[model samples]
Target: MTVGFVMLCHTALDRAAQVARHWATHGCPVVVHVDKRVKRKGYDRLVQALGDLGNVRFSGRHACEWGTWGIVAATQEASSIMLREFPQVRHVYLASGSCLPLRPVAELVRYLDARPRVDFIESVTTEDVGWTIGGLNLERFTMRFPFSWRKHRRLFDGYVKLQRRIGLKRRIPAGIVPHLGSQWWCLTRQTLSAILDNPERAEIDRYFRRVWIPDESYFQTLVRQVSDQVESRSLTLSKFDFQGKPHIFYDDHLQILRRSDCFVARKIWPHADRLYASFLSDDPSAQATAEPNPGKIDRLFARAVERRTKGRAGLYMQSRHPNENWENGRTAAPYSVFEGFSDLFENFETWLGKATGTRVHGHLFAPDRVQFAGGDSVYNGALCDSAAMRDYNPKSFLTSLIWNTRGERQCFQFGPGDSQKLIYFMAADANAQISVISGAWAIPLFHSNRNFGDIRREAAQLQKIEAEFLTVLRASWVKARVRTWTLAEFIENPMEPLQTIVDEISPRSLRRLSEAPRLADLTGFGQFLQNLRNQGMQPVLMGDFPATGAMPQPGNRRGRPYLVK
Candidate 1:
């Protein structure tokens, strides 16, 4: 008792003829059903191509639109012809035009023969169906879908909402539980005949005609009513992405398809000559004796889906830049943002890079141009010093920088003087390590040698921006590791905060910092704040500074080493 195939052909008639010939030559009956939308010439050509094979027959044509009932009617007509024309068939396998046999037909026949009574179909209840997309699960069966979802999407959506608002729901036929699954299935002859010849066939058909995408649920639900030995799984290997679109196999997926050991696979690229030639050839290789375990390649498909949807962390490519907050990560790796550090220290970027073995830069968001390390005009990933381009999408620029240089740690100086657009974004990112010394921006103004009036006004603006930025860092949603110290408090004992920051950046290094980045000459800097206040700009962020600024020493000194015995 050989198996029969019911092929639903729409596009790629030549490829369908090839697969039909392949199956017919292997002593399997094939019933081809072409979609009615195909032109007359293409239909006649397909008919003539397979005319020599007596085991192959053409079923009546039907206009099969996606997510519509015409496909189910076509499948039913083709399945009926398959059962009547082939008496020796014990199983009928439903396949699409794009399907190709991955294993020998004899192995599939043998596999079915071993399980003569079991039917292979993915039948699951709505509550258990986790893979259903389009937000219509139980509603698919309960509501009337008169409008085509593809051609009349607005009407379809509006009708669904109207039904929901009016509490309108159709009554399911008696003695049949609604089930959903992949449309492709392999059914035992007994089960297929029982479903086709059921006494209530007309009533069942009427109930399913208005059901949304009933082809997937028509046979899937009826077989449950007639057959007791259902396997609740399909023998065909098919995969869908997160959006419920099938993944088409190409030439490069030859090895991936072979590893599945599945008898048949669908949605193959017609242009994949290598895959067709390799699988369809009669090479004398050992027969695949393993069970049809598509799970072997499930991990590979899952990863493909993930890469398409979430993508690699911190990567902002043109192909798949996710919507805001939908990214897998804000940045690929952990990096440090030093606020006020540059203003308080001399050559702070160089000192931090040397201390933690990280790539350090100055005022990446500076107005004129990006201050890349060593003042280069260009950096990795072709990121240039174009302030206009960087300002256009600062978040993308930052994420691309981290993604391009992922293996190394990155440190950059940020201050109120730079763009504040990325403040909220960086504060929310878990990979950011921010160190802030409040009130340090005044140092640059103090030493600017500008008139006191201009310095006071600029200081007020910078102070306002910094205060708003600090509020965001202190927000509950901030995920980055943050440490904020007033200028006076930090200068009093700078080594402790410096040590903590370095340890976090390079946790594997166990050595304490032997020296610190040189502090800017803060002598009389306390007078700077007092001056701001006298000019009516209150500098409260700087913790109580002494009227006479005194630079705090490292506090303790290491004695000269003594030789041990």
Candidate 2:
């Protein structure tokens, strides 16, 4: 019953008083860890509002640097101070100033009560994504500044950019795949005690000191390593954009905030009037069910698995495809592999365009085409191939497409399935004996603002990709490839706006012909027969979408069985 909140503050002084006030009524003790670099100008008002609540407040300021270990130092200070003061507190909920409690305070307590042994921490011992515990750990442990460090963050960002281009870790150490996830976590007293008493405290600190953004990984990592069962997901509410920056909250995100079932959200801007107003205790039922908006936070988490119409997988790894093509019918050699999410594709396509000297048409499929008909956010990232299934496993996203001769996509769609039949219609053997296809490559991803950079640059990349695509199209094997489906008829459903990219970007390839029940036809392109075409594009990467119509419900996993002939 000794549950307390460890509030980490950067700015947003106005909400502190409100958050403190809410927690006080819930009878949960509070501890504040304000960033030292920033001032506590608003504390006077916040204190006055609290009016002498027993909650304790500490005054050590934490100056957190981007992608650095200062974050770990700050959290360690907070935890130590809290433990010293509240020896009786069992669970310390780590949160930020911007995050607000979405659920009634009581419901959160009950949820914790049901689970006493498990740590809400997420720690993976592997040296892969989480670099803190990896072989090249020392390069980071030493206080060696490889890149030029500058006060101006953008310049520092420039340095980071340089490192990325040259195969170096800007903030994260070299060769160490840093484990990343939500910075906020809820930990038990036992776990906290173990972390404080860790025998390798000095050694651990040595590494974290150099590691970037250690705050997000430190406590969670330590707790995860010690705890038997650490939940991979966090119970907080916060969303980061494509560049890993937290997305500012606006009224538009209200639907996500309302429907999201989380305990808290963080890194909110100072002036989120609508967001603050929405949290007011207006409705009684809203108190109990309303917690962290699961919807808002869902955007930050990436899916790890992909299952299709006939999925049968346990441990899945990405299979790198060949950068060439295979022979087919009338078409040149059919493309043996798709350049998925790779900058190399940009180079290849551009080279091919130059080689073949024609607008090289290409296609990239969706990882889970059926799942993200409306948008990527609509995806649940999990699928069940059978209707009677009990537990539907989570999966990554997949996409598909048909492109014009310019290496630009004409239409795109997604559906889920497994590796077995993924390349059945037209697939080449890739590593792990899997058939990988291009999903969502012909759309925003290939030429978007975030990862792809300036639109003009993206266009240049597209031109290059076309050049590389020529090599595929000219191959004798690819000439035999057939048409899978008409672009217009392929993605007419409201669910898949991703396919709309095709309608807008590649108009020349498909036309709504003036023939019969449906005008969508490929009669103009008489080269390939429909019989030899792939039934549909396959999702080689993320989640596998079930063909026809199938999806996993929110918090529930079930789907119609794949009709196997």
Candidate 3:
């Protein structure tokens, strides 16, 4: 006995006609049900294309809408016609117009003939299914969904919520249990007839007419009641994304489709000339007698879904810009942010680049212009030094910098004088290593030849901004590695902190820091703080700086490091 095909065609009628003719010419009867939504001209053209084939026939048309009962009605009409007209057909394979036969038709016939009693349909209990998206699992059966989810989304959502609020549920038919799976299936003639001709079919049909996406569950659920031997899997290879949208096969997927060893694959691009020409050819390699195994390409599709959803870290694209905190990572790689370092040390960027052997950049968020290393107008990733563009989306700028310079480690300075927009974003990123010398902003203000009144006002502003930033770093939710020291404390022991920062950045290097960055002359800098305090603005973040501004000495290293012996 030969296998028959029942196809549901909507758009792309020409391609549908081609596939139907291929099946009919191969001695397999093809019964097709076209979506009534197709215009008459397109329908007539499809009919004319396949008119010469005697085995090809058309069933009654149905207005098939996705996520509705119309598709199931179309499939039922086509399958009934296949069983009635083609008496020689033993197995019926339900497919879509876009489905292409991957293996030779004769091979599929031989394979089905081996398991004549077994029905191949992906049937699984709702509780066992975890792949369902859109929050509908058992609710798909229990709750009545009269509104079309796609066409009338608001009404559909409102109805669902209304039903949920009232705790309304429908009782499933007594004899049958609801199951869900892929819409495509290949079933035995006996099983198909039993489901189509069941005495309570009208009642079951009425109940499922209001069911959400009955096309996927009607046959899948009913076959369990009638069929004794069920394989519980589809012979067709179809895959969906995390969003429940089917993955369309194109010319690039020819090798991938061949690797699946599936009997038929659906959702082929109509214009993929290469895929159509290659798969539809009479090549001997297409006649392999291997068992259908879709798992061979499961890993590939999983990665595709991951790439679409989570995406590559720090790489933002128009196709997917995930909501905040939903990204795979905030930045591509680990980098260092020096808060107040540049303000306290002269030529700090150059000193850091030499000491750590990594790219060191000047204040990236400076208001005037991005002070890139060596004062270049453009930097890596073609990023410009325009402060306006950088300020527009500071998060993207920083992420782009890290992503573009992935292999090489990056270090940049930050201060309250620069843009503070990325404060929260950097604080939440685990890749950020922020070493802060608090109250160091005062050092630049002290050195600046400005009016004392203006210095006092600016100091108050900078101190407030840095204090707020430090609060974020100390917050429990912060993911960045943060080390904060008062300006006075840092100068007292600069080597230890410098060594620690360098070790973390270049873990492979064992060399200790031999020389430190030149500290800016701090003569009377403490007096500057004292003067600010006298002016009624307490220099709290600076710790207790002495009036003389001399670097505080360690208290003689606890009795001059005497030997215990």
Candidate 4:
């Protein structure tokens, strides 16, 4: 797997030369793009350092500016030159002059080799809640700004305010949803070719030319349209503060950097000569060793097991009503309980299962008895009316155990057996959901608004409970040789932490679970509710039981199932 590096640089030519030499030593070709703003003397010095390297090539200079379209242009030019010059290269990594490799080049090559079709690009939808940069997504695309705005900030500020005041908004070009991410990426040759050879490339280029800070968005949005093999993570590890400026790596950060899985870390200060020397050295110790840590290796095995067992396992989930409001008569919304578990199960059998090729037979059980009560009682609460419980097919051996006060304790007997694995899933947000439900259900005379501090304290207590639950579950599972998982982790990626469990138990075959039906069939209640929405009905049966609304008839070609009375 031959890899190529495209280094974009303005200053620190000496540092860039060091990086190029290091990469070249691994038989990887380097394509350097120097900004046209570099003075002739500096340009000559850069050439003098890199000219002797047989594998290094330089692209035509562009007058690159920070956060502008010029940066995109520079990268495109360098990538184009690299692809044309070295047709044998399989993957191309985009980096900057001051960035240093975190792992050995051989290890990085192997990592890429393992996933040749995947593009290591960190991308998120532009409107994501966590992307909290002030006016960046809005102003960058909407306002027409020049590169000189940095020098004449006040003038640009006034212009932006005036544009927003007048209700001026630029429409993003057709067929593009805005995506923002780190500009650095490692892309496969197929993806690169698709990007370079796109039919609408000219239109895209013209549109982004007027966009502010297009470098971070341009390639990110466009490449995603071409390939679904994109991994929403960058191979470069970078940290930015509140203002979005990258943190400069210092000598003190060496250990932290060494531990990262990232191929590179960037924005090294020019004064760190010793640090630069360490990266440029030929000694093996200079590069982070690729030896697998025992803890990490264990986790890898668990993930492998998770991937292997997906879609074919049996899931036994036991959830208690959030303990915070147990004394209060207020109960969780019947639909919320149905929806949350439906989502959890649907994701398990459908999204996560299909994504990992594992399907699970889900059996959910919620106890009927009130907390602190000693005797058996009917579960006449919202759970009884929940579609999740009512629609479970007992004949299929799929069970939803409600109305039994001792069910949760008794269900532990149905642990992993006969080559099948059991995963226990619970929601971390159960307490918060219960709190909101209780507050909403409060009588008008007794209602009291919770302050932010109160909410924070409650949340902290809930999180502690959640953590302790996991810790105890983990210990019990370790002792019993069964697996335990959280709803949040399953929804996100269950494979991440499995390696440690796998390491400890060292199962003969990591594979667990059996082939099962599709998720659409498994989540019958969810699909029934969704069909209700499709028919323009508001299906709200909050305090009511048995979901006695008009259920769609089964075998409806539209894929809607009728609710049985």
Candidate 5:
């Protein structure tokens, strides 16, 4: 596994040369891009220092600027040079001049060899996390100003305010979801090639030219679109202070830097000669160990994982008719309801898995329908088959069993070998109320506007059905836990309800409840509620109480429904 370095540097020629020489010593090719703004003497110094390093080369200089397209342009130039000069390189790492190698270069190469397909990059949708300096706003993308805006800050600020006041904003291009991330990353050759070869490469470049801090988002957004191999985590260790500038490594931070799993650490001060000398020590043992033990950070990470997954209750949401076009009722152009749910569930499961080191299964009803966009099955033939649920290994992280409400009754039988802990999620929205009253049978006609009626009338009918259902559950002695939550609440902030549900259903002590009835053995819902109440547990309503305004009003369309098939 050949590794290449694309280092972008403007200052500290000596430090930049040291980084290049260090990596080159490990048989890695290094491509350096010195900012055009740097003095000619600085560039000459860098070249002279690295003249003996056969694997190191320099790209054409560009005037790199912070928080502008210039940084990305420099990166592209350096990466292109590396790809051309060293065609045998399998992976290219992007780093700044101040970044220092934290671990042995050989160890990093070995780690990459094992996970050849995974791209080490950090990324988040712009809408989800927003920009780093300030929260997300339209001004970042809409305002087109010169890079000199930094010099004439007041003028640029006033210009942006004026544009916003006049309602000037650029619409994000269709088929593109803006994403933002750290500028530093380690990418595979395939990912780099894909980014360079993207058909929309020119369009993307033009759009980002006016964006503030385009370097952070440009490669991140494009890489995500082109590669599913992304690991969503950067291999570089960088900590930002309150001002959002990266913390410069000092001698005091030696231990922390040495213990980190990251291959590199950033913003090393050029004047910290002692720190640099310590890092550049000739003795292998003086540097970071080849396989460093997990320190406090590892334990902290484990604790975080346990908090999210250990004993967490699974939430299963059921819809009568599943379709591809059922996202937040706004982005219904591409994804169906099933696709949207699958994506949400997959993200949730991924979060749990990463935190807990356990696999969380998503049991989607009629997998064939979801996969092929085929016809939906009314009955859940999968749930009725107990062997299928047993095979899911519920002892790990929670199982999110998604299916239509038709066969929900059969799901009561689902449990681990001896555990009876189960939580049923009931939607408290108007649409759910309508579904409960009309059942799946009337859904098609309802969607076609045939059975539509007054919102208050349908709501009242739904309340009656809910009361009756709860009454039946209370009387039946069921063993599983049941909770009511609205879709809006779940979508708005899932962590709150998820944590509550997990706390409710999780075992309170090390000792198992000997008298707890098995889920499959419970004859009615009453048995479960009674057993739960006997154990001092009460029924849970996981989300916020629905406001009266949340109730559906007359003439308000529920949502466009897609064919189940």
Candidate 6:
């Protein structure tokens, strides 16, 4: 039996064929199942977009309604069609339209050819790894979904009310042995054939009939009960959103996606076209990252300020008289010095919103700043009135980054081989909020060199983003609240390097330890500090200068935009 690609897309008719084309070009048979809910005309257009595919065939239509039995009907229909039309088709890979092929199809075929006996589906019944959001949903299971009542709106409403009354709510009931995992699966031909031919199949189908959102759980549960060879992990990268939406909208949470290194990430928005294109391209360096290219970020900086000031200049124009006599520094000092506590609080609050990730409530003089220096003042010039900022409530100072009650003593510091590198969070805002932040809820740039901020160009890119954010502030006259330690401050009030830094004090702190965690690790505080002192960054290297036989200067073209891969 040969491995075949099976695409099960609900409404994305036009997009399915993109993946089909990828598979078909490699001589792999493609089985497409367009949702029956889609219009025939749209389906026809999808077929037309497919162009000529000698090996690919549409696996009939399926009307896959969410939280309904229609999805099961579609999957079964597609599977049956696949078996009848292509008897030689072996393993069926369940994929969706949003999926993109990163590894070549030939590579996939090669991988499967190398592994014949093992099924790639993850079905371990682990409590922590992946479990159905189960509880009393089983009552929805006890009765086989009766199609006759599906259209009976009154009956459905009553059924839900009764379920809730009987304590049969949504939680997965104790010891129900609930199974769950990614809907996508790669099943062996023999297993799939057995499932198809089994006489007990009707019983299995009936059980799944009443299952809530059976599409996701049916195959996962059935596969778990059917085989022990199932791996405990799915190869597909499907994002589950908070509202039960199938797609992830990564406008603000783009950082989260970057952290999840699944081979493929998806359901990207159309607005992210540049990033989508570059990511799917054959080259990664040229990827349209959200990084602030000085040129690109600069353009946005100007445009943003323009929009803020557009048609609104009148609001500020009347404030000052153009020919008014200007005050000397002595006359201006009174206003600056006599500014009320309320004004100072307002200024801190504004900066807090822009930079700090901590929330401050009910307090005027709550000292929100934490200085990790000798006496204080990273920059003495900026500390003119900061002397009074000492003796702050420590609790208020240690609450950002979800570190409330964790105590400042419990707060750990890290260095990533550069004096300036320690200032990464400042780029996002003021104070590497993740590192130096104790209070004020806000996202500071380069928060920490720990698990966040990469030493790669990403760090530089983050700086660019924060710089861009700052430029916006400067244009709007928003004062930055946090200031860095000055050379004098470091000399007069230098604090000991954090223990995390001490652990890595060896290696003469000269050579870069591979990646991080070691004293020589670029991530270590000492190493990061050293890098800043030496004016070095995480080394970016060029790979594989394609031999002249293949191409000219191969590595150079691919070098500059250091791809994560």
Instruction: Estimate, for each residue in 432-505, the C-alpha lDDT of model 5 and write its tens digit.
Output: 11111112111121233332234223433433444455443344333223333333333444344344422332
Across 294-316, the per-residue lDDT of candidate 6 in tens digits comes to 23223443554454433231122
Error of 1 at 533 (Å): 2.5
The candidate, 2 or 5, that scores higher on lDDT is 5
Model 6 vs. true fold: TM? 0.46
Candidate 6: segments with Cα more than 4 A from true spot? 124-140, 143-158, 164-178, 247-265, 270-565
What would you estimate as the lDDT of candidate 6?
Answer: 0.44
Candidate 1 residue lDDT tens string, 386-481: 999999999989988898888998899999999999999999999998888888998888788899999989989999999999888888888988
lDDT of 5: 0.56
Residue 463 in candidate 6, Cα distance off native in Å? 53
State the displacement of the C-alpha of residue 244, model 5, in Å, after optimal TM-score superposition: 0.7
Per-residue CA lDDT of model 3 for 266-338, tens digit only, reads 8999998887777777785754668899999999999998898888987876665646567888899999999
Model 6 lDDT, residue 57, Cα: 73
Better of 3 and 5 by lDDT: 3
Counted clashes in each candidate structure: 0, 96, 0, 16, 23, 38
Model 1 error, position 359 (Å): 3.3
TM-score of every model versus the real structure: 0.94, 0.48, 0.93, 0.51, 0.51, 0.46
Q: On a 0 to 1 TM-score scale, where does candidate 2 land against the true structure?
A: 0.48
For model 3, what is the error of residue 161's alpha carbon versus the real structure, in angstroms, after optimal superposition? 3.2
lDDT, candidate 4, 1-565, per-residue tens: 6899999999888888888889997899999999999998998888888888888999989988775678898999899988998998899999999898777788788878888898988778867737446566756776777535677788777877888899888777788877888888899888988888899899888888978778788878888888879987788866664456676878866655666545787878877777677656667676665532223333433554444333122222222132332221121111011112222223322332333332222223322212111222323232332334433522112222222222221111111111111112222211111101111111111123556344434434433433443343344322222233322222233233323222222334465434322222222333433443454533332111123433223232322111111
lDDT of 2 by residue, 68-115 (tens): 665667777778777777777678788777777667777888788877
Which predicted model would earn the best TM-score?
1
List candidate 1 stretches off by more than 4 Å: 284-287, 319-322, 548-565
- lDDT (C-alpha, whole model) for all candidates: 0.89, 0.47, 0.88, 0.56, 0.56, 0.44
Q: Residue 441 of candidate 3: its Cα lDDT?
A: 90
